[model samples]
Target: MTANRRPVIVGVDGSPAGLGAVRWAADEAVRHGKPLRITHALGVPGPFEQPFEQVVDEHDIALDAATEARGWYPGLHITTSTWHGSPAHVLVEESRHASLVVVGSRRTGGFRSLLVGSVGLQLAARAYCPVLIVHNAERWAAPESPLPRQPIVVGFDGSAHSDFAVGLAFSEAATRGVELVAVRAWREQARRWGRGADLTRLAAAVRDALAADLEPWQAKYPTVPVGLRAVRGTAAPVLLAEGSDALMVVLGPRGRGGLDDVRLGSVTQQVLDHASIPVLIAQHA
Candidate 1:
């Protein structure tokens, strides 16, 4: 399928948080003019095979999610499906054809749950498309209410992954008509630099680097009011603080400092665990 036509996929598990993801996915679909797909994964059955009742329950969960999403967008082009596999594996496969995959921050059960245990991490690290984890899905209950007019915050450190993240962040901010805040975090070596003039030069250098990285995106999205912040601290903490009131926090799967063998970066993992708002892991297109 064409990139613009790829559907926005949401995994549901009959939980309040899952339903919230439906709402967010529906809005995203409308915002970007894409179809919405509501899915449920019924983990691989035992040797005895799956029971009829269990299959029926899973089907109902998918349908219920679709119904709720339709209520929010009556004209939405949407579909529902059920798969037999681990939640992470099923969604990762689906992500191959999806524009974005969304899930709730919490789940109630094991079979169909998306965020329980290592499922969320797996999807973040392995999905072919971007993965969005919606925190506090209950807050999205009302479809007519406007999202907060807060800025969208993104972190970049000149990695290929972060470059994709910055592009996605600019697109999101442009769509929402909000400011885009691009942040870069750095650490100073106390042994090499003194407190006065050295620290001042370091801050300026960091700012210049950030601005250079953002120049192309700024030209592409001229209307998106941009803010550059170069802070001296850890990536995770700086991002968490900068995005405390943001509409959402956007990050790469891994940063420049991330080891080549690691699937998910430590900073990305830390932000996912502590951020109160939605977090999106940008996928390389």
Candidate 2:
């Protein structure tokens, strides 16, 4: 993998959130024996707005992130790139063949604007590689401490891509000595008679079916703390609500159901919206 692609890619905006992304990218780059490349997009100014200094500022931030990464890992190579386009478009385009793309959610606008800003949301949905959205510092980190331990929550629906997500989640859990939580969600099912779907039972049955698929993995990783939860509700909301303190979040490239599944099961899409955390998206589903 090292020989075939860019080592690590992170977006920088100089905000605390962006710096947090740089921090995580540096750690991964150092641990994997890979270089760190930082990129920032020179966003076009809104109509009639030609902020020439914006480009220079964006460049400076990218370079700053590169310097920070190199400082963390002296042996870790560093490269920087600047593109004149939409941030999300440029980042996702560059992420096509890179190891991973990391970004931070900093609201240039208001509160709701931060949830899934333009660049972060687009990358989360369209990036060809994994997109990590850095939010807080474990909700409990020193001013200059290494990242803290948190559960690695993986979203699954039984497809091959979902399988890859599970494997990635397990690998991360094993590597980090952290807990792993796997959650599967389904639409509430209707009961007999002229009744609507039982959302509660639907969540349970879906959870049970998904739990069964995890049996072999459970046997193989007996010592790794694992929990399976099948919940009733939308996947994005459930995962988002539960992953607040999670070390990282992962999603299958698609879903298990089919066209409808992929279209609807895109918690990854919604997860990136205004979310603050690291996310991994497998290529298969």
Candidate 3:
């Protein structure tokens, strides 16, 4: 295992979803050639004190998770830690020094009740670095495995936040030696649209803007093949549908202006809540 500045941090518990996160994180760590840090957050036990054996059991579960990931990536550097704090807070703090933070889609509850767990949501909203939420089940059939040419789908709307997302997506695609799919969704403004108005010009403009936004990135990552798509209608649904065959979906939180509820944009939230593949939320520096 080689020492590196930024390690891949993952929140791990004994649950199946947690182990899936560990596996996904390990794969990413290998891709990035960075160390893997597996973390377990132990919340305070209730008034009824837990037996000594139970305490040991909890630690063992975390240890086992780390061991599994280490075994899978023999040459990868791996470390494990248990912190006494809430899972979201602990993982968020860990993200400060990590290149990326990974978490399970669901934890400790009936799966049908929620599409994503609360902890995963909190971390995605607050983590300093990129946050990846890995779903346990594969919801789409990929035309090929996530190698050689898997596409990294990014949502772009020409905003600064979207710019950040595009940059990250380009880097990830370049790193994996894969293609980058930049999608921009547009719709005619009802106020500007008249009956039987021609939308051809509007569609062309949207497509051109998307290409312009991607031009610099294309130059920066010459080896990465990029495909720009200007789709009609809402951004969320378009990106979600594209997630069907993507290795991962990269998106930025909605821009912060004009509205108090813009901390995490609704479109980004929708994709995070429903993306079948791992979703990486690119945070603003």
Candidate 4:
């Protein structure tokens, strides 16, 4: 991303969630001194019998909303576009070279207020740069008041997807100039608890591997402060604690679990459900 040209991209469709995203994104562009590129993704229900412009009525409204919100950031460089495709696809593809991507959370069903939507999951899974899944509008509008507190942190397991998440976290820390933390969650069932000696060796191995994975990043961004820890707990609690006061959390979408959810990385999903801050997931590429 060029220092003078790269813009912050946002996805919108005029939902309350989308409005929250626009409002948050406007501030982000100003904070970073980056242009805001607002995009609206639309779709056609049937055959393409009419012009592309006729189907995406939502984009017009989104454009209007973005225009009106620009008042909050009078100096921000803003642009708008309308695309026709999956929200995840359109937004993620557009963010390929973006400094950062921001989007709002979808409402959870009934009382499932903490739930995340399939599109948010898909974007987080696929986006290469930092993606902030804005869930709480009231909180984010005043982001600078008190944020970027590191807690409930998580670390990658060295797969490509996890590496992408690492890069995401690294960029976030670099941007904020805060400590980028790394965590490896551990769980030992009764079957393995008996071998106390073996446990010691296993713990050592996890430690060694984590150091190796973080080496390249540490060296590349030497000035970016870092903290490394291997926790003996489940993914949810560890992540929640690590991500506390976190501006954004990063995770990966692994596979389907016993339940019917399309995205099976429940740890990340659960974090999204409960956390007040933003969550970004990197799915298998």
Root-mean-square deviation of Cα positions for candidate 1 versus the true structure, in angstroms: 2.2
Per-residue lDDT of model 4, residues 61-92, tens digit only = 56775675676677777888876566777777
Q: TM-score winner among the candidates?
A: 1
Residue pairs clashing in model 3 are: none
Alpha-carbon deviation at 88 in model 2, angstroms: 1.7
TM-score of each prediction: 0.92, 0.76, 0.86, 0.70
Q: What is the lDDT of candidate 2?
A: 0.69
Q: For residue 80, what is the lDDT in candidate 1?
A: 95
lDDT of 4 at 27: 65
Question: Local error of candidate 4 at 107, Å?
Answer: 3.0
lDDT of 2 by residue, 65-177 (tens): 77766666677788988776667777777777687777665545443222236666666657676666665532311236768688999988888768877876786687678
**Candidate 1: lDDT over CA atoms?**
0.87
**Per-candidate local distance difference test:** 0.87, 0.69, 0.76, 0.67
For all candidates, what are the clash counts?
A: 0, 8, 0, 16
Clashes of 2: 8
Q: Look at candidate 2 and tell me the lDDT of residue 59.
A: 82
Arrange candidates, best lDDT first: 1, 3, 2, 4
Off by over 4 Å in 4: 1-6, 23-34, 42-60, 83-100, 109-116, 125-130, 142-154, 188-205, 255-266, 283-285
Candidate 3, 1-285: lDDT as tens digits: 233558998887666677777777788899888888888877652342678787677678678887777767689888888766678888888888888888877534653222247877888788888888887522211213232246999998888887888888998898788889999888877665557546888888898988987888888888989888888888889999987799889988674231544557888888877777788888743
List CA RMSD, all candidates: 2.2, 4.9, 4.1, 5.4
